[model samples]
Target: MSSKRDLIIQAAKQTFLKQGFEATSMDELALVANVARRTIYNQFDSKEELFNAVIIDIWKNVKPYRPEQNDEAQHNPSKGLFNLGMAIANYWSPPIVRSFLKLVIVEGDRFPDLPRNFYRLGKEPMIQSIFDYLTQMKHSHLLKIDDIGLATQQFIGMINEPLIGLGLIILSDEPDMQRKEHVVQAAVQCFINGYQP
Candidate 1:
């Protein structure tokens, strides 16, 4: 059984995904959620608040890096980096994420905080995780990186360029997995080669 809050959130996501944030109304949300209008307000103060909750909920679904899984990767830089690239690719390639991103792009001007909030909620933490992983790799003497931040950006760019810059923007279908793997593997190999002692 779902809580009232959870049910409302799920319904809101579906409604927003289908009709977008700007067009979705509280009444529509109540109807879809099968809850009273007051119940919706009791959980979320406003539509903007509910939309932010939806973004946070989506971000929560994307897996974050686990520090406990670091030991094996620390011993092998190539393996570690390939795994990291794949994780990033996997996170960004989801249909729900793509839909959310499109919504952000479309609604960002109207709600100035939307894009920033989405980045803070989703991309920022993932970037920090990769940065920390790179730092750990450096400390372990697995790789020699002059600037962790730049290296992190470059590695992420490499993974994102094709998947998002090309695939998502142009294609209607999910970005091809083989292409994603190729890009990730190539990026990892290039990164390893550049950082080798």
Candidate 2:
């Protein structure tokens, strides 16, 4: 069975996704969660805290990278980068993430921490992971990257633009797997062409 906290977070995710942060009320959350209003206060001090918890919950789908343990990254930079790009593309191309991003854009002025926490917890770590992977590749003499940070950002930008940015701003449907593959492959190819020793 689900714990009360889990139930509350789940309810909050659905509610916040539907009604957004400003419009959602603790009383409605309690009712939706099938718990008392006090139960919510017991679990989360305020609605903002609960909303942050929902963001954290949503980010749980993002798997962290440990470059040291990744043989593919160590031995094969092209394959590894393509794999990483695909992972990033798949994660951010969904409707839930798109909706959450829209919510952040809408409410970031009122709750500044929303976008900060979103990037800090989600994008920063992923970027850092890619940075570390690039550092590893450079050290191993697999790739000749002079600036790992810029390369990491460039690689990520390449994948994120078509997969996430287009859909978030103008496109309505998610890019198909073939499109994702093409984007990642092109990113890896361009990165390798630029950085290969």
lDDT of 2 by residue, 1-197 (tens): 99999999999988998898899999999999999999999999988788778888888877755556777667998878877888788778657777888888889999998888888777788888888889888898989989888998899999988777757776488889999999899999999999998
Per-residue C-alpha lDDT of model 1 across residues 13-132, encoded as one tens digit per residue: 999989988899999999999999999999999998998898888888787665438777768878778887988888876678878887888889998788888898888888888899
TM-score of 2: 0.90
- Residue 33 of model 1, lDDT score: 97
Which 10-residue window in model 1 sums to the lowest lDDT? 166-175
Give all TM-scores, in the order shown: 0.88, 0.90
Q: Kindly provide the TM-score of model 1 when superposed on the true structure, using C-alpha atoms.
A: 0.88
Runs in model 1 deviating more than 4 A are none
With candidate 1 superimposed using the best TM-score fit, by how many Å does residue 67's alpha carbon deviate from the native? 5.5
